[model samples]
Target: MALFKTSNPALGTKTFQDAAARYGGAIDVANRMTLNGTVNRTGILLICAFATAAYTWRAFMQTHDPADVSGLLMLGVFGGFITAMVTIFKQSWAPITAPIYALLEGLFLGGISALLELRYPGIAIQAVGLTFGTLLTMLVLYSSGLIKVTNKLRIGIIAATGGIALFYLMEIILGFFHINFVSINGSGVIGIAFSLFVCAIAALNLVLDFDFIEQGVNAGAPKFMEWYGAFGIMVTLVWLYLEILRLLSKMRSRN
Candidate 1:
């Protein structure tokens, strides 16, 4: 038969309306993955959120204690391990694993936030507010067509992310060698500027996440892609929140 046909009452039209409809529906479903499959991803995200808040409060309460601060320092390793496991075994951990990763990430975020708050009062709130603000701003820019995500931009983002990750690794190595420089968080004018630059890159990641979801929908990806999409969003949000926390911490130190 032909690729498509129309069922008009008068003359038969060669329009594949049914095929088009099916294709459109698939795309719509993919795009609405988060909304439609909200039960799974949202449950994980909500649990993660609650964990983060609780951990943050616990950290805050113990901010003045040196031993608590020491323990908080270990979050980097713990969170990094969970993230690596998730990424490496995305297939194996698509179900229960993502939520586990989220919880571990929340613990790390909470610890870091608490440490920062101890050093700089009122920074936790600032970081939280800024994270949400940046998210909303990016959403607006994306919807208004002010920002277009291109393949080249994706390449750049991936490259920058790699560079940032490498820098942290180097910092850890230096710490082990007992040759700490400016400060892992940065210091003085140079540190604050660097923090701002990193924060900007984190914000840009959100733009990429938004574009990826839309593209996945247009490409008619399977429904499981919604979980994948939500996972991506969670990663970007976590990074953005961390960057904001770092920036706020720097500002607090300066003041």
Candidate 2:
């Protein structure tokens, strides 16, 4: 059985195992995944995301019209979803599709962040700082062996992540029927607590992503898997940032 297991759908339990099996004996030393390479690819993807995000952010600021970037936002929403699905199913294509996914997500995030920033000035920067701070803290803990990815912790995080995902999906589905979760979505105590819980879970996911990527490297996954690993980290980071943004917005609304 594969020892690697992560709550991240992008980096499933079998991800490294399957990649190793397929590329076994075919990967040269230079073509094997490396921690440094994955980090570099992750940096590249972040830059790609930031570039387009800046474009949309500036557009919104200049026009002060959501309509101007509405099309791009929708495109990012749906296109990023499709691209992520493709990358998840076809891991080998991650080297190509991952950057595309980042760019699309940037469009969506930029528009949303700008809209929120307009309403709650400085919230975006606060959220960004918290998001990256949590990421760095988690990285330090994980690297120091202070937070071990034991089976129990792994399973707990996975279960919590799944529950959160299901709740969000239900919320979306109910929206079409005109049913809304006012209390949970409002700026009330319940909403704030829920957001805090979600933010914690999202932060824990970064640890799982790190462990999964390390396992991939140890398994000698193909060099392209470096991109895949970085892609997985990006997915977690996006989720973390969005959750932090929501949490900050909720708190700001109370004041």
Candidate 3:
């Protein structure tokens, strides 16, 4: 189960070649930027970001009780996040539904941040700063070509992510039964170590997202794809941010 790096409908074949030929390259096989290419879709990414941030702020501001807000925020956050993935899996509705995903996720995050801040004081800001730093660092490494996004790597990421998701699902089930085998971050040194490892995997996924965008542009995917592309990037970023937040919270608890 690879992480699915490229959405090449062509599957690397002659059909893709014929389609590219007949359609004058609806999916640009060559890497070149057109005025209306995927690069343009970046605006959609910004739009999504603004929408998310605004809603999140609204959710936070509306909350009067810290613990109550945190609990609801967590529910909404997980709901929105899980919903986005399910929506994307539907494929046909990705464009329309993905934006809604962004909006909901924003509200979820904003409320969660407010809750965390109320309880932990400055954890929210610290997490944001740390998340940004990791993102920037990953970007620099990617732009310099120090890290390559190979098909194998993508597959590995997808597989690991699936494993992690499975563990999380189990944790959720056990939590309901009042059975606590796994810590929120994992238990003891091993749990903490596993959290760090998972965090690294999440960070590496960012690298894959960057590669996918570059590949899409080079292939000359449709201009509309830019929005799709940006949306994809946002998905990865949001995931990364949440994981970072969780990791930080666990560390704080330890201290």
TM-score for every candidate vs. truth? 0.75, 0.96, 0.75
**lDDT value for model 3:** 0.62
Report residue 74 deviation for candidate 3 (angstroms).
Answer: 7.8
Q: Give the TM-score of candidate 3.
A: 0.75
lDDT of 1 by residue, 30-149 (tens): 344344463367457657765765665586575456466445445644764666455434532445655656776666677667767767878888888898899889989987999887
Q: Comparing 2 and 3 by lDDT, which wins? A: 2
Worst 10 residues of 3 by lDDT: 7-16
For model 1, the superposed segments whose C-alpha errors exceed 4 Å read 1-47, 59-80, 183-185
CA error at residue 57 for candidate 2, angstroms: 0.3
What candidate 2 gets wrong by more than 4 Å, as runs, is 1-5
Best by TM-score: 2
lDDT of all predictions = 0.62, 0.90, 0.62
Candidate 1, position 239, lDDT: 76
Candidate 1 residue 72 Cα shift, in angstroms, is 7.6
